[model samples]
Target: MVLLLDGDDWLYLHPAMSAFDSAVARGEMPPVTLVFLPARDREAEFACRSELWEAVRDELLPLVAESGVTADPGRLVVAGQSLGGLSALYAALEFPELVSRVACQSGAFWWTPDAPDRPDPLGGPVGGSLAARLRERHGLTGLRVAFDVGEHETRMLPHCALTETLAERAGATVRVSRSASHHDRAGWRHALLRDVAWALA
Candidate 1:
């Protein structure tokens, strides 16, 4: 099963979401399952909150287990964009065995100026800080990560670059792409379909 977390804007019902849905209808994606995680909104102060991760750990995981979309945690994939991207990383890092792959598109890795005492707005340190923990526990042997962002996404470009490096160090197979510009949902939608297919396959 694939989990798609909505961004801070909570605009999952937009064109980008449609692109994924359309791909499924066309059989570009396999007979896959999808789950959506709601967003906290663009103005929320603590963007990617511990409270949110609590929901995934205490609530969502069990739900997925019972639903049986993926009986093996290693078959599960999680994805998101922007703040949602942060939430996806948080989920995968915290429960690596439960999620084998992560696709972060145009991720907002600049939530915190410095790593906070708690998980930052993006749920961890800027640029793959959680990777260290993953390696220590999950060992990073089977983890696969796909990261992509537009070249014009200036503020997030550095974080994206650093995150790719961190994922690699953590022993994950990482892919980085920078062919597009930051143009809302349109710029990122195509990458979502392509990366999801590649990772989930």
Candidate 2:
């Protein structure tokens, strides 16, 4: 199963499902269920909090299992962009049993615990709280993660680069790449598909 955060917009505006089907047809990825989950309040939910991860573990996964999708519990993939991307990595770190594969695009790596209230949220740290967490944690041996950031997102690069390096250092099987556009969903669309496929592989 692939749990996609901020996926409602991606599904509606882009031909994401079609692209998935095409990739499957070409033997690029296995046939799997895609769960597009929309966040009610992105700021609160995707802030790398326990509440969001708990809801996913307790409520969402059970519902998805009840639906009888041909999903492998051991190979679950989580894909997200921006803040959603941050949340995806957070899940992998905090709930490793639930999330082991991740396809993250342009994660908000500058997010500290108190970043939302700061005058300049991105100015506080190089890679923020996540980087510190990654530095301290080293249990990512079985994790498979794909990290992608837009090539044009210059300001976001340092944070992303630092986080990516730290994740790799933590022993995750990591794949890094750059997208063509800036901090936009259009640029992330293709990377989402490609990275998910790689994660599954």
lDDT winner among the candidates?
Answer: 2
Estimated TM-score per prediction? 0.75, 0.96
As a TM-score, model 1 comes out at 0.75
In model 2, pairs of residues that clash are none
Per TM-score, the best of the predicted structures is: 2
**Total clashing pairs in model 1:** 0
What are the candidates' C-alpha RMSDs? 4.6, 1.2
Give me candidate 2's TM-score against the actual structure.
0.96
The local lDDT score (0 to 100) that residue 114 gets in candidate 1 is: 49
Model 1 CA deviation exceeding 4 Å by range: 7-12, 15-18, 21-27, 42-50, 61-71, 113-138
Runs in model 2 lying further than 4 Å from the true structure: none
Clashes of each: 0, 0
